[model samples]
Target: MLREVTAIRYVTPLREGGSLPGVVEADDLGTYVVKFRGAGQGPKALVAEVISGELARRLGLPVPDMAVVQLDPVVARAEPDEEVQELIKASAGANLGMDFLPGALGYDPVAHPVEAGLASRVLAFDAFVENVDRSWRNPNLLIWHNALWLIDHGATLYFHHNWPRAEAVVHRPYKWDDHVLKPYATALATEGPALAARLTPSLIREAVDLVPDEWLDDGGKDAYISHLTARAAEPEAWLP
Candidate 1:
């Protein structure tokens, strides 16, 4: 399970995407970028964040430490914006938090060029989960201490949003034309398959197991397990 922490202060909003996740100080004396469960996409987005981010961590990728942040409505008093206050009240429970990188900068491809090995693995991982957010215009990536770190995976595993037709699109081809890292995935054909082969069912399950129960929409955990297990088993169909 991911570490659990209590948010003590509402620092400020990150304002990256529509969700408006914010920076918060936790009882652990650590700061984190908290993804509110009450945001527009609902708990499912948090679920994707935990499951996918954890998977990246397990794959020896550079990702921040994650925690389940328990929020209390009392903190809303510190927020003046009516909109932000509402968001705090709504997310008065468990929200996903990622350790904040103090000096990290938004990824600029020109500034931090990726090697073919790292690029191919990330591209393969994103393709496996059908993530459409890692584009050149909005690369969900960061550069901290001169190393690339993956972030904002809340857009992955979209099939969970539409269960009935999820199977139909399991083998869907990824639209890589706009993927920011596609240009560096020089060894995708070989690197992609090598990475896919390592995603055994047990490995995937380890990541999914971190999600809390209430965050799951009735039988959601089982659905995720089934879909991802199947997807991992058939990499030839989805790995770009």
Candidate 2:
């Protein structure tokens, strides 16, 4: 397990992250892509990344290891971009880290280069489950050591925005066009009791608990917990 340590030296900000992600090196010699929480995107975004990434790994997806990291002023040399400096400063205390995938260029789904057909299937599962973050522009796919690696799964399940009365099942299960995963799409949609069983209440609870308190008020937390509990109970709606 990675230790919960505070303070990492910021190396450089990732140009693609819309002026928010600061790449850094932890004292342990691990490179990290750190994100701040002050963007009003909230801590739930970070929680989503950790939970989804971990769960996908359990389901046999190749996700790089991830952890929350703290940024120290002594190490980071950040000049204000003037546009979003306040948000950055406010989030100074709540920085997050994604274990960096060095020497990897962003994946272009158009090229369909991911050799692992399984990755496409897994990503299809992600899409069917309504993971809103994995788009072609910021596919969050990485290529490391000649193997496809996935990262940054924070934006997902956007329906939570409306706070509709939590309903688990939508009539049609994901059709899962295999073409979306290969030379066309590599992953095929698969359904099984085992994968369904994996999305448990305890796991959801734990994943929700990982979010920082500052991001959610007591009421928000209670509502999220309630909704997640209900959602987990009807696992077929999500995993199928």
Candidate 3:
């Protein structure tokens, strides 16, 4: 389970992407980027974030610490923006909060070159999760303290958005042509298998277990575990 914290203050919205996740101060005196359950994509997006982010962290990838943020109505009542206030009202309870990186910059291929082995691992992980958002135009990565960090995994595990089609695409090949790291992932043959091997059944289950219960609707938790476990088992089909 993720460390739990209560939102002590609602800072301004980050407004980086469509989900409209905002920066918040929590009871632990830590700043966080909180993704609300009331966001357009709802809790499914939050679930994906937790599972993928935690899995990446477990695999020795750089990711911020995550916590379950308890949202109180008092914060909603103080919001000047009606839209933001409504969003808060809708997501009155538990939400996803990630430790804020104060001065992190968006990843740029030119300024921050990724190593071949690391790029291959990131590419392989994205393929395993069927993440379609890691394109050059909208790379969801950050550079913090000269280290590459994975972020915004709400766009990964897209299969859960349509359960019936998930099974159909279980063995689908990942299209790496548009992947931002594809050019740098020259060691896929060696690095891909090594990274994929780390995702044993227990590791996959551990990642899935991080998702909160309320976020899992219609046995979505089991579906996620099954889908990812299956993908992990057959890396040859998806590894680029």
RMSD of each: 1.0, 3.9, 1.1
TM-scores of the models, in the order given: 0.97, 0.75, 0.97
Query: Which candidate comes out best when scored by TM-score?
Result: 1
- Distance (Å) between predicted and true CA of 72, model 3? 0.9
Better of 2 and 3 by lDDT: 3
Candidate 1, residue 3: lDDT = 92
Question: Against the true structure, candidate 2 has what lDDT?
Answer: 0.59
Candidate 2: clashing residue pairs, number: 8
A best-first ranking of the candidates according to their TM-score comes to: 1, 3, 2
Q: Relative to the unseen true structure, what is the Cα RMSD of model 2?
A: 3.9
Model 2, stretches more than 4 Å misplaced?
1-3, 72-80, 110-117, 164-194, 219-226, 232-240
lDDT of 1 by residue, 1-240 (tens): 889999999999987667998999999999999999988889999999999999888887788999999999797586888888888889998999999999899998887789999999999999888889999899999999889999999999898888888888777877778899988989899989988888888988899999988799866677888889888888888887
Per-residue CA lDDT of candidate 3, range 169-219, in tens?
A: 889998878888888989999999999899998998998998889888896
Steric collisions counted per model: 0, 8, 0
Ranking by lDDT: 1, 3, 2
